[model samples]
Target: MGASLLPFQVVDYFKPGIFPLMFLTGPLLYLYVGSLTIEDFQLKPIHLLHLIPFMLVAIHRSTIQVVPISSSPDLVENPQYLFNKVYYTLLIISAFSYWFLGLQLIIKHRKKMPLYFSNYTGKNSLNWLIFVLSLFLIVFLASFFSFFVNNILGLAPVSYTTLPLNLTVFTFIMVYFGINQSAIYSREKVHSKLRHQQLSPEESLPKSGGALLSDEQIAALSALVKNYLTDKKPYRNPDYNLQMMADDLAISRHKLSHVINSGQKKNFYKFINQFRVEEAKAMLADPSFNHYSVLGIATECGFNAKTSFNRIFKEETGLTPTEFKQTLERSTN
Candidate 1:
C-alpha cells in the first residue's frame, strides 16, 4: 500500500490512502523488540496511543481528498502540500525513534541473557533482530535524507523513486527472518521465572552496599559455588538459572552474579555450561552410555536443544560431539 503511493499522481485514480502506514512502522518495530526482550509484555489499550499520529495523518489526508481547498498545481503548490510535508517529516522522525529504541532493547536483552541461560540459543538470541534493525536504521536515515532533499530543499527527488525499492528489500529481509527465526519464547516459557527472574532495583544490589568483596571472599564464594555444583549438579536441570542457584545457596542473585562474573571470571551461563559440558564429555566417553546418541547425551546433560548442545560443546572443547565420540572410540581401540 505504501509503495503504491510513491508515484502519487499516477495512482491518484486508485485512491490509495496509505500515507498513514508510515506511522505504523515505528510502533510495530518498538513492539516487536519489546515482545522479544520483555517476558511479560502484552498489548494493552495504552499501546494504542502510539497510533495517534497515524490516525491524525489519515484524517488530514482524507479531508484533503474530500474537500478541494486549492487547485492541484504539481505537488508543491497544492493546498495539501502542507499535510504531505508534515506526514513525511513525522514518518522520518517516527522511523528513527523506533529504530533507536529497538537497538536499545536488543542491547539490554543481550546483557540480560548471560544471567539466565547457559547457552544463547537461536530461539532466544537477537542476532537476526540486530541485523534487521540496523538495516532499518540505515533505510530510515536514507528516507529522511530523501524527504529533506525532495520536500524541504525543492530538489529533483531522485531518491523518492528508490524509496519503494528500498522498502521492498527491507520487507523481504524481514519475511526471510520471520520464516526462519524461531520464536523467542513460547507462551508457557514466557511466564517461566525459572529461567529468568525480573529483579527490582534493590534486589540487584549487594548486601555490602555495592562495595566490592575482598579477593579471599570472592575466591571462597567461587569455591563454594563450584563445590555446590559438583555435589548437587544443579546444571542437570534444563531450567536452572542464577536465581535458582542463589536461592539454593541462601544468597542474593546479585551476589551469585558477582561470584560468577568477578570471582570466577565467567558469566553465569558459561560457568554452568562448563559443568554440563564436562558431564556430556564423561557420558560420551563411557561405553555403558553407548546406547545414547549424541543428542541423547546432550539431553541427559541438561541441554534442551541439540543445536545449542552441539554448538556449546564444540565451543568449549574445540570438537563437535560426534568427533569427540569418534576420538573416544579410537582411544579405546
Candidate 2:
C-alpha cells in the first residue's frame, strides 16, 4: 500500500503492477497478527482463498495496455482507470473488514495475555505488533480517502494530492516495524508451547460450582495449586505463565485455570500477583532487606519491572511500594 503510488508519483519507475496488491493489505495484516497471537495458527487450504482476488487482478492486468502516467495523469478515459476506481472502492471495503477482524484478534490477544503472563513485556504481549497494526489502519484510511476524493471524484487539483504523503508515511511505518519486530521477538524465543491458548473459550472458568468438573476434582486441584504456589513459590519467576504452572502440576491448562478461577475466585494474573505483593510487603518490613531500593525489592518479589510492581503493589496495599515502606518505618518510630 505504501508503494502503490510508485506508478503515478514516479514517472521513470512507473509500474502500477503493485496496484492489485491493494486487495491483499487486509488479509496480510489480519494473518500477520493471527500468526503471532494464535498458538495453532497455520496455513490451510481455506486461507488460500484470500489470494484469489490478487491473482485474478494480476492476471487481468497482464493482458491490458496501461497508459503512461506523466507529470499529470488523466487516465479517466482509459478502461484501466475505471477498473482501478472500482477495485479501489472494493479495496476500501475489504481492507476495513479485515482491519476490524484483525483488531478483534488483537483485542482478544490483549485480554488473553493477563490470563497467562504475570507481567506484560513487549515480546510477551505483542504491544509493538499491535502498535504497527494501528498505524497501518490509520495510513490506509488516509490513503484511501485521498485517492477516492482526488482521483476518483476529481474534487481537488493535481497539486492537492495526499497519496504521495500517505504512501511515504506507510512505507516508513512498515520499515520501522519490520526492523524492530525481529529484535523484540528475538529477546524471548516465542515458544509455541507457552502460547497454548484456546482463544475460543478465552479460558473462562465456569460461573457455577456444578458447571463442568466434579467438586471433588476442583477441591483436589485447588489444594494442589495452593501447595505448588506457596511451597514451591513458582510465582517468583516474573516470566511465569499458565502453561508453565500447568506443566509443573501435571494438569491441563483448562483444569488449572478452572482451579484458580473457579475454586480460588482469582484469575491467574491476580492470583499470582497477590503472592508477589505479599512477598514485597514482607520484605518492605524486614530490616534484612533495607539495602534494597523499592525497585530492588520488587525484583526480589518476582515482579519483572518496577512500574508494574508499583502499580500492582498499590492496587493491593493502597499505597505505592515506597509509601508502604515509609508507612512501615513510621509505624516503628
User: Considering summed lDDT, which 10 consecutive residues are worst modelled in model 1?
Assistant: 65-74
Q: For candidate 2, lDDT tens digit of each residue in 200-315? A: 22134343465467676788668767766777777787778887787665567777787788898988899999999998999989999999998898888789899999999889
**Candidate 1 local lDDT, residue 205:** 38
| TM-scores for every candidate against the unseen true structure | 0.64, 0.80
In model 2, where do residues sit more than 4 Å from their true spots? 1-16, 68-80, 159-172, 175-211
Per residue, candidate 1 scores C-alpha lDDT tens digits across 1-333 of 244454444325533255577688789878977987876689999999999998887676655653121123236456556555666677878888888888888888888888767667655777888878888777757776965676655565443345566777887887787777654544342222222234432344344444666566677678877887887787888867665676666666666788789987888888888899999999988889999988888888888889889888999999999999999888888
Candidate 1 to truth, TM? 0.64
Residue 39 lDDT in candidate 1: 63
Pairs clashing in candidate 2?
A: none
Candidate with best TM-score: 2
